[model samples]
Target chain A: MSSAYLAAVGEDDSRGGWRPTVDARMVRLESAVEAVLEPHRARLAGADRVTIAPDVHYPFHPSTGVVTDPAVVGAVAAWLDRELGTDLVVVGRSDDRIAFDRTASYLGYDRLAERFDAALVDLADVPTRNEYRAVDGRSVALSVPKPLVESPVIVVPSLRPTEEGTAAGAVRTLGRLVTSGADSSRASVAATQMIDPDLAVLDGTVAYGDDPVATNLLLSGSAPAVDAVATSLLGRDVDADVALSPLLSDGERPVAVENPDGVDLSGVRERLTGGRLPPSDDTHPAVSSAYRLYAAASGDAVPPQLEGR
Target chain B: MLSQFRGRLTDPKPLSIGVLGVGNIGMVHLKSALAMPGVEVLAAADAVPENRDRAERAGVDRTYDDYAALLAAEDLDAAVVALPPFLHAEAVERAAEYGIDVFVEKPLARSTEEADRMLEIAERAGIAVGVDHTLRYQPDMVGVKSAYEDGGVGHVPYASIIRLNDGPLGRPPADTAPPSWPLDPNAVGGGSLLELGVHCFDVLEWLFGELEVRDATMGRTLEIPVEDAATVLLRAPETGTTITLHCGSYQWEELPEVNTRLRLEGITGTITNRDHLPKNFYADAARAALENVASRVGGEPTVFGPTFYLRAHYDALADFCEAIRANEEPPVSGLDGRRSLALAETAYDLAAETVAEDVEVPEVRP
Candidate 1:
């Protein structure tokens, strides 16, 4: 059974709000980061180079808890630099939608990478070697990036839900990095098996539950185990998640979440249950149809935004 | 100077027009023009094929990959310059070569200097210029203006307006790739100040004549290329009203509930744009749709009638076309656009100064 460790982050700002500054947040994050990584140090100590893969899919503001906070990554890098002193690399992949460099630049990953003396790598441009793994009787192929395979990795994923209403856990974060013909869940599962990351530190410092919630918490464990814990916090069942279901099944014990700090996990779980991403700005399909019908009935010109959308 | 533009459209029965850059806003202009009486949208152009495809699906007759090629190839009375801010100057210049008038999307130009050059070209070509500063045309804003004009809010000494939206890098569940240029200072000239604040400045100036920037402050919620939020202190000397204007691209804006607030604290009572707005947007929309359908039986059509906010865009474009056909000045002239830019530039300068002032000088220990 894989047990996940949970650590509380910061107290509510007396002035009424959470996280006044990233620097101030980082100061509080360093200890929590230490607490999470302390157990994983034995696994990471042997690696010459450690790659930190974060959820850098797009340049959404960190405060919205849509993306991993750069500060959390910085604190983790600082801890590793102090404790293990391993060669560090922070990696993300650019997709057709947005460039990784652009996302990195906007989210201050460049500065964080610089301060930590870590190389920020775009996995899309990196050399890849095809790797095959079995996911539920299906042979999944992933053109796994060499850096992720070469070094022990620490995946830092934000506590949020994907547009598909599943936890955007450690598996999906890596799922986004690799090129694969398999479905997203299969790709994520294969990528996890390929990278076989040493640790995953879930940045619940801020969590997105329908909207952003400053949970002021972080959890650390193995990639799948952390995701299992995250899936539970997001009020989702592991069996429902295609990516999580396969990993958590087949005689695998349920995720054991150890909250020694006495953090209010139940309260956090309540706030985040049935949470999903905000619907796109595009007019809802039902509303659009109704509007078009209204227009046809009334002899009104269809709205430009509504026209053929 | 912009109020006195010289060119008139010789009154064609169906005003032949071309839409340049059929992106989101350009598409709105195109659709509005298509539905407009006595206006024929001949061609539309966009660099992005997806946008051109969308425009074609929206009923454009022809599409061009290059707007300049469209301007040179087609003879048009006017072109709606809805391209990116950087392209506005060049697009206008190309339209001027064909002696075509233009209705440009706002912040008119990246800077006042760029706007001056564009206006100079239009003046030399004897082509009229209109700007899409549509906030004033919104029904809620119109109601506020009507109430104020009627002196329902007597002697408003203090007024404040705030306009906010999730800019290029939109809010939450980040699904799509946001365009990079909106946050790039070199590409866009500035951030929320130009993107959103200019709209507030235009609407405020429309409400209270000739605003003067008193003091201002700008902030970035993220370490993105530009300031996502800004607050400006302004004085409308003509009305003796000191106004506070705050605009930011930081707030997550969900559709149907736009984040814009305008309030006037008068001696009699506080008047808010919110009060003027419909009590229920969906209910109001149903009413508007019903009214528009009923009107269809008797008379003229309302372009983009189903969407309440988009009516402003339709009315603004309609107003411009009307002014051009009637040989009258555009209601929102190029000078009016330039004036908004000027106010924004002043606010930026003042905000920069405040930031500099906040940086305490190190005491030299000799």
Candidate 2:
């Protein structure tokens, strides 16, 4: 029986600010990370080299809960280095929008990787292999980075909604890391199935709902099972989630979430049910048109900004 | 039309204008020139075909992929130098060869040295140089100036100004690539200090006489190649006022409102730019629009009436045009622009010193 393990990070008593320092948060996250990683500790420790994949899509401020915090990754690194003494590598890909190294540096991953004696790798520059897997009864081929498949992997994804109003979960984060001709849903499903990651850690320290909600919890399990749990926490329908439905336990929606902290799941679901990224366009067209008409009728001037975008 | 160049017998009446670089700010000047009563936008130029197409859509007669081509072909009284700071000197030099005056977008030039060289060429060509330092012309700043002059705040002490925005790398879900020039110190000269602090310097100098940099600091929030944040301590000897100015490109700004705060603390009370802003921008804009239509004769309709900050750009260009028509110096001349750059350079020097001072020196082995 697959289960997503949940652990509540202990409260910060020593410091507070707009955000706690990464080191401070890392110290606080140690217990939670240890608790979640306990189940797979032996398997993870035996791996020659472990790769940690994170949602470092861009350097959006982590406080907004859009991207995973470096502190959480730092905490995981500390745990791995201390408990397993395992060699670790943190990975993210560079895209046309921004470079991986640039994103890593901005998110403090460069320093965190160094502090934990882990190598920071841009998967874009790494060797890749074509892997074909069956997802939703169709073949999906993905050019996956070699490091992801050659070693045990742990995916750390933030608790947030995509611009398209879907949970940016473990599977989707890993899915986008590979090159594929398949549609996004199928590609992501295929990527997860092909990689068969050892663990999926969901960073819900500050979960983004209609706005950012301080959930202060971490959940870990198999990629799809953890994503199913995340989907539930985000108030999403598992059967409605085509990419996630195929991976979930035979007809069981997010089988069993073993919450060690007994954190109220209902209250969290209610708060984070429907959330989306900030609107790209700040000003409305109607306002500009109204202002333009008034400017025209009055023979007064409308600033170019007030005129139209 | 080429025969009517300023080198010949060009009429300043209904000033013939060409806009160089149809980027965001260039488009602002282009539209302002198009809408102004005594100005005619004859041509526009940009290296980007899409930008040229945008200018054509905005109703310019001719568009050139190169500004030099526009200057070589158009018989115009003036050209608006709206290109990147790296290209300002060349753009102005090209405009000068045709004996055309110029209204340049600020910082005027990347550095004081570049500004001096550009101004020297304009002087030799006998062309008036106007810089688009629009902060002083903003309504709130104007109101602050009016009240300060009226002794609303009997000042005996301190002032502060802050300007912040999400520069080229806007906030998420940011999907586009930020321009390379803004983050390149070699191209832009400096980061937020050069981009935004100069405007604060210009406005502060307008309010209080000349300013002296007392201390300064620069910060980079991201791993970008430039300082995204800057703070400067300044002393105005003439006004006996000490001021603090902070500006940054690290913020996530939204439209419909801008991040600019100017406050003067005095013996009597504080005078803030916020006090002058309309309580409701839309209502005020609607009211202004309706009024502009109601009174057609002798009633000055606020240009860029609905939006306050952009109105400053329109007014700044309009003032430059008025100065050009009258055969006088621009209100914010190239010299004034250089003065702001000099202040920024000094702040940079002081900031560098602060960084040096942070380094530990081994005490001599005694």
True contacts kept of each: 0.73, 0.59
Consecutive 10-residue window with the lowest summed lDDT within model 2 chain A: A11-20
Task: List model 2 lDDT by residue over B57-113, tens digit each.
Answer: 888989999899889999999999999889989999998999999998888888888
Best by TM-score: 1
- Per-residue lDDT value at B248 in model 2: 97
lDDT of 2 by residue, A1-309 (tens): 677889887654444333546887787788899889998787697777889998999887777788898889988888888888889999999889988888898778878887878999999998999979987677888999999999999999999888877788999999879999998989999999889999999998888887778788899988888888778878888788877888886745536888878888888888898777777643567776776677666665445544443
Docking class of 1: medium
Task: State each model's CA lDDT, in order.
Answer: 0.86, 0.84
Which regions of candidate 2 deviate over 4 angstroms? A9-12, A18-28, A81-87, A112-141, A210-214, A232-242, A250-252, A255-273, A288-309, B1-12, B292-302, B358-366
User: Which predicted model would earn the best lDDT?
Assistant: 1
C-alpha displacement of B275 in model 1, angstroms?
A: 1.3
The sequence of per-residue lDDT tens digits that candidate 1 reaches over residues B1-366 is 001111233455777899998877888888888877778999999999989998888888899999999999988988999998999999999899899989999879999999999999999999899999989988778888888988997998999999999898887656667887788788778999999898899999999999999999999887788899999999999989999999998888887899899999898998888987888888878887787888887866566665657878888888898788776788999999999999999999998888777677899998
Task: Give one digit per residue, the lDDT tens place, for model 1 in A1-309.
Answer: 778999988643454355637677788788888899998789999778999999888888888788999889989999999999998999999887889899898888888877878999999998999979999898998899999999899999999999988999999998988999999988999889888888999999889988899888999998889998899999998888888777765555677788878999899999999999988777778988998888778766777666544
For every model in order, the TM-score on chain A comes to: 0.95, 0.90
